[model samples]
Target: LPPTGPVRPDSYDFSFDSYFSGIGGSGFFLGDPKLLAPASTAPTGAPFGARIASAVENAREGIADHIRSSIGGSEGEIAAALIVGVRAGIPEAINESMRRTGIYHIISISGLHMALVAGTIMFLLRGAFALFPDFSSRRPVKKYAAAIALASIAAYLVISGIVVAAERSFIMLAVMLVAVLFDRAALTMRNLAISAIAVILVSPHEVVGPSFQMSFAATAALVGAYAGFADYRAGKTTAPPVKRSFLKFLSRKLAVGVGGAAVTSLIAGSATLLFAIWHFQRVSPLSLLANLAVMPIVSLIVMPFAVLSALAMPFGFDGPFLYVMGKGLTAMIAISAWISDRSPVDAVGLISIQSVLLATIALVIA
Candidate 1:
């Protein structure tokens, strides 16, 4: 271990007990650093997981190089971050700007990314099956497609370095897949509850982490909102037969897109606001604005292009897709930066311990 360097009031005192308890670390070492000779060999044998990780890392590096060559600057870094969850190339200024604007989650490996990948796969597979009468009519192509989507999500989670939030999302996706296999509703409060329970059982410590808390909070809020308005949705579906022209249809779709974006941002932002203030002590006043501007581009263009590029790389046809992906990422970065620049500075401060406790209780109850 590196030197502790003048222990302060909050300095972590290392010990064997702490290590065993998972408090500090496993051990400490003190030695003069020396460089190894070029001819010296180290461990190179990789297990299945190691091999998978190596492949993922190599692909990320290759894609990063391609992105850099196509579109330099923070855009390449943003593309790599969005595609593979590799943010090492991202500049500190961009990171700071994202955090300030509350749009950093876009680049993080979370439910958004998982949902995009799964939804895309399921849609494409179902569409292909629809085109083939034999599969759609005689076989259970939807369930099989969902299973394949689950597998793809698993691969993505692992390659992106599975963390607590990703694990929860995967569990939810898995539960949904199982539901589809059994011909049950996929999106329900029960699925979210099961996923939360599983995540807590696997890593109870994650309950206190922002990723776990914010994710469940957002999902729960959405679930409750949908449940609350189920009757309205059911009623509306029975009387929605107003035929329109192509131009009118296009206008309606654009309106729905804007409205849906606003509502989603509102729900998610409201759910995570207190948690953000409690954990990071900062609230991005422009979070909804930033998300509204960036999410459409990310989901519709950046992520799809990146995923296609990734799939095409093995066939040496990824350059065009990556170039388009970089363009989308560039626009996204500019939007986020602009929003961040206009947002106010200074972190939101909790008034007292009582307020914090109250907020925590409210979140838990919700």
Candidate 2:
């Protein structure tokens, strides 16, 4: 190996590496310019990891272009993933879509996207399985579908390499899977406890990393928020949806996405401040608004192509879909770049690690 600081291979928590690559990519692509100096654009050509990332990204680009063309096509889930999974090569129209919305880039796949993908697939598979009465009526297909969902999620985790989210999602899913496989009803807290214990035992240091802390925290908060929303939507009075006009409807969506982006940025931003103060010296509150506008498109448009592309390539019939997906994903990327290039985002400056960590702890507790 080339002479350098002792190799601190963070392999113990590969999940961190996955998440770092994701947010780090976003930081490089859309983050404030002052954050990255000469090294920001350093070409990691020919390195093993770079090669792998490139191959995957190249596939993502193909899938994205395909999705863009075949608006309604086979493997639309994968098409969707490409935009969310890899935002590096998005084009124009998708970008415009986001600019109109006003949130963050939707490239980073999280619990929301995962749940959607899983839910979509489960429904699809369930419908398919139902066609065959024997399979449909035999045993609870939900368990088998859940296992398939777990497998699909694993594929996503590896492909996206989203560290913290992948790890935690995998663990939680695994717990659920065990219960399903054994035909036992699961207790959520008990499963969660097992996952937590497994995570620490596997990599104690992950407790200090942004991926570990932030992923868990965000998952918990979102889950809580979603539960509240579900209950409220069922009957209780809650925050009313913005009144809908054609133009106003669009604005409300953008506002909703921006709101989500703000929450995400605050969580992810705090993690960054704790782990790498030198890299991020200030925080930009407006980033949430920007993110909110853009993120929905990224999730709905850009990232889903990874799986979609893979699904389409087999019969050599994927080219057209790939082209469309690529175009849309590329459009999404181009918009983010355009926005970054023009009225680029600015930061609020960095905080001390201790302060960041303390804030993180507080957020988690709350």
Candidate 3:
């Protein structure tokens, strides 16, 4: 090795290093790591990859600066995290609060980010297509929208630096878009399986990481739960053609929204419970309650406004949107703080391996 510090192979996380070696990369570098001044632009005559990376970095930094100016606090950091999938500036106190409340994933680019962005793109594109009635009526406008949404998501994946969690979400989103093209179900177990397999093949070590394990475990449990209950839901829905007054329709829609939120929180929280305990040495007992209280705001208000803010930044119109997103995040922070305070005793010790193995067998049998 070139002029390096003392050999520190023991300091490396062996599993991570092993994964790197498995992919034909050296886990250790040959020289002392360099500390350099930050450059605002691409290096002179850099290659294509370097240029694209620099542009993406600039875009992210621009978003971060805008958030700093408009929101300007931990809330602003949260906005940046949600908007650009960057979490570099959040305070440790707030981070722990979120983790304790089980909302830290909101700061990461996970399935929720992919779903919100792709869903918004699809909705907008389809609505725009529908404006031309003659053309929309004749063409597969939905499929066209799906294709465009996929392309937009791909661009986002590149912008987000294609991290492991984002990569998994992108694969799942791509599979769903392709299913749209073929007139098939999008959010099914098969798609989940395919995405999981793709991620495993690309980064097998990710299967051992918290991001991969928790996300896939939560998703698989949700899929299986829904599949098991599908027949009952279908039977109940078979008699749902009755005409209703506007008030009743609104009430029913509200009920569905509330019920869906509760079920989703319960399922995702329970599914990831073991992983949480194993990794963090504790579980958020009120995770479902926290998610139910905060996520709709994050999904319906924060994420949409954040996307709009990012898009509007180049035109100097992002301020109001960023302010709105900060307001939503402030509410989320308050909720997290409340939960953390009220449920101080919710944390538990780490689960034993034997118990985990037994639970795994039981889960499989179930």
Candidate 4:
């Protein structure tokens, strides 16, 4: 083993004896290692890319610090995870609870978070432009909003550390925003395929990782299901109702919202089930119920306030917004805890690689 010493910028050379381990084990073990090194000084200046990365990292830390100062405790940790993909401070128990409840993705900073951020920004921008009808009508306000939203997504990608899931989401979203700019269909299998190809091209190794596989699997399933539903709706020949009561309309909207959330949870959970089990060795039986209960809080309360808080931060008015976000996060954590406590025991035994491959093929055909 190398001797313990002060941290240094010097390169090192190691010499060691290697031996093979017992059956069923892989890789050689090193024995009687010796280290040799030449001292070197640290670089005086970073490359441009490194400088930009350092700035984004500092900004991410600042945002996390602000969240902790304002919210504190587990809620602050969760807020940091949700907004900046910083999960380092989340307690192991809380993390386990979320995983058991099948809502761990809530903290993972993936498509849902990115979509909400971009959508909120676009909505606000378009609304602001609509206040001046003459300008809004004269200009392509939607495209302009898309352009800004795209820029926001890019900034968010950097700030969130550009993990596999975030990278995939960014690519997909960028394609959609570019589609909008070109007056083309945004959400389609073709666009998704493009995004997938782009991701694979950039990070081929990630294709084998759970983050890439499960993220794409869930997205593909959702897109296919929604596209099929769209086709089914298009085929419907029934005439629209000429009149409806306001109460009935409100109830219908509520029903659709609840049903959509439930369906989304089911589809995504089902799609990612194999990968989740293969990677983590757990099955979340109550995931649908947990998602149904908590997703609305996340979507309607947590994320909206998250965006507001971020926008309000520069003005020092983020406290109220962060507090509201913390309230929603508190509720979400409670719900995860409750559901996780009652979740069934995980499935035992290993699944074969062939089985996973077959499932993937079936998913594609579907």
Candidate 5:
């Protein structure tokens, strides 16, 4: 999709979740989590209405478990993002940036994060298992690796709670893990396609939502593109150049943070902007720079700590880590709030959900 390229053009993943606050009328949009429970506080929990919350939580746990167990890799970074946890305030330049951006928050836990995580964990775990003799054992290390990932994924589901994009990613990854266990060949495109089918069958109404359609559309595009690119690159001439040292590579990672933040904003914010374009009433240009400026710190330092601390808490030895994570998260909140207060954030609605879906279909067809 011409409109969806900034985040990871080839993949159906772009979730710039600017906020996770229950405010901004989120319940009105997130559709259904396929589970339900009554609304009681604390230990009382949900009452007779088990149809809403309980089912959703159970579904999330099951999906998370399956996914983590399927990974022969490290998707920790992506898994950390499943919650759509962070919520930054709007920049001050355009005062209405708040209401619009808030109103525009889409499902953040989408397929791209899952793909990145699965691929990352797979590559890392495989490499680690390769180098370390301890892990290269007669035992079912691959299976265990997948299991651990699944456990982590389940924790992720409970911690993050909000389900949309992440759920789809979780489901697909789980299926692939099953395939791995069955000794079947697994390809990304095929896996993604199958996942799409499964998601639709289970939740027919998902077809009517922007999160479901957009998430898959973006992911499919990326998978197809990357596969084609990989083949193309393999056949290209002029292979080698002056090799850079580790420091150079590290620099790229750091730089990638800025680029990634901007890209996230572009992918998410731009789509929303399209709807407001006709009236010249919506625009989110500042979101990119604003996100770029802080997201690196969030991704590299803050998010990791927050995720780690949260994970550690269940073990009853998390205070220290929790403190660290809390501080980092706090810093992010403060920074985002300050920036929004200072900047001239402007935005315009660009397209309707219908148009977005049509464009996504056009993208799929192309």
Candidate 6:
């Protein structure tokens, strides 16, 4: 292979001979790789999928370049990772800190990112529709907003390079949005199951991968926990409360928000515990504290600015938004580093297959 040509990833068709690794005593190795043919130069030669992928790659590069030019430095790199799913420029030290503190998913395009994007779009669209009383009174504005949000997420999925985690998140979110269109419950176990089935059908091998297992586990646990909470609340009846002072009301709302974030961190961490041990052989004991400290910045400031900056990019108004977003990113990184420094050393020894299976079974049952 030469470096001079316009060679796409899928441009070359190659064949290789496989052999057992003599020294490693595990896995096979490829040898004597041969290039069979280059991609066709004809207008209609490339496969549709390949062409779409190429365009996506180009878009990702363009986005990355724009982010770098606007933000610069590691913040720009993090922005690129968060928005376009490109992390090649992020320093390894920062990545290690995030991984140790268990906030690495902030940089990874996953369910949280998808949810934020969809939720923001839905919120804005619904609010806009609500301003028109006549229209809102007569039409199913929620369904229209959901439909548009779905389309936005589909575009986001393509922009993010359609990785396994992003794909799974998109499927789950798309199902929820579709449920809204049909006036059905969106976050039920049935919808989760449907999303899981869809992902497995598309990439069955991913079921055994860490991204698939950890993602689904966390989602299942969160859904089950919230569903149980909803049921419990439904069963309990309370008299109407007396009105409180505005300060008291605000404090109570803040408390509830913090409590919810804490509960979410605990649930997701517990659900992914076994998978983390099995795949990475480490656990962040301070992850709950880290999430509590940093998630507000991410959820409230970083992601919102990310969305705003993206929307404003075409009009050359993203500079200020990106600057504000960078501040939030800086705070998040600092918090993660602080937490990582205090985190306990990695847990020793590998967990056995039986233990992993048992934990997985227990998770499923729960």
> lDDT values of the candidates?
0.78, 0.55, 0.81, 0.84, 0.51, 0.85
lDDT of 4 by residue, 273-316 (tens): 98887665568888899999999999889998998988889999
Worst 10 residues of 2 by lDDT: 2-11
Per-residue lDDT, model 2, residue 354, is 70
Best by TM-score: 6
RMSD of each: 4.6, 10.5, 4.9, 8.4, 11.1, 7.6
lDDT of 2 by residue, 286-358 (tens): 4454565555655554434434545566676766545655566445555555655555444344455577657
For candidate 4, the C-alpha RMSD (Å) to the true structure equals: 8.4
Q: What is the TM-score of each candidate against the true structure?
A: 0.85, 0.57, 0.86, 0.86, 0.58, 0.87
Q: How do the residues 178-229 of candidate 6 rate in per-residue lDDT, one tens digit apiece?
A: 9999999999999999999999898776676778889989999999999999
Error of 2 at 353 (Å): 4.1
What digit string (tens of lDDT, one per residue) describes model 3 on residues 1-366? 222222333221444534454543335778886869878889899999898889898987786777877898889888777767678889998888888888889888878898898888887788898789999999999999999889978877876767778888888789888998999988798988898888889888777667787888788888788887886777774654889999999999989999988998898888788877766567887788889999899888898887777678889998898888889888999999998787666567656768877886776576
- Compose the digit string of candidate 1's lDDT tens values, residues 1-366: 432432433222334224323554335459986768532222377587766666766765666677676667888887766666677878998888888888889878788888888888888889889999976899999898989999989988876766556777888778888888899888798888888888888877667666787888888888777776786787774765799999999999999999888898999899888777766667998888889898999889988887777778779888898889888888887887888889998476544547767986886676
Which residue segments of model 3 deviate by more than 4 Å?
1-38, 45-47, 240-245
Q: Who is ahead in TM-score, 4 or 6? A: 6
Best by lDDT: 6
Can you tell me which runs of candidate 2 are displaced by over 4 Å?
1-117, 130-138, 156-169, 176-193, 230-279, 282-284, 303-305, 342-345
Q: Could you give the candidate ranking by TM-score, starting with the highest?
A: 6, 3, 4, 1, 5, 2
Model 1 CA lDDT for position 175: 86
How many clashes show up per model? Answer: 0, 66, 0, 0, 51, 0
Query: Candidate 5 lDDT, tens digit per residue, 187-298?
Result: 5878877887998877666664456654565455555655776789789896576678999988987788666555555655544343334223445545665565545554
**Superposition error at 162 for model 4 (Å):** 2.1
Candidate 1, pairs of clashing residues: none
lDDT for model 1, please: 0.78
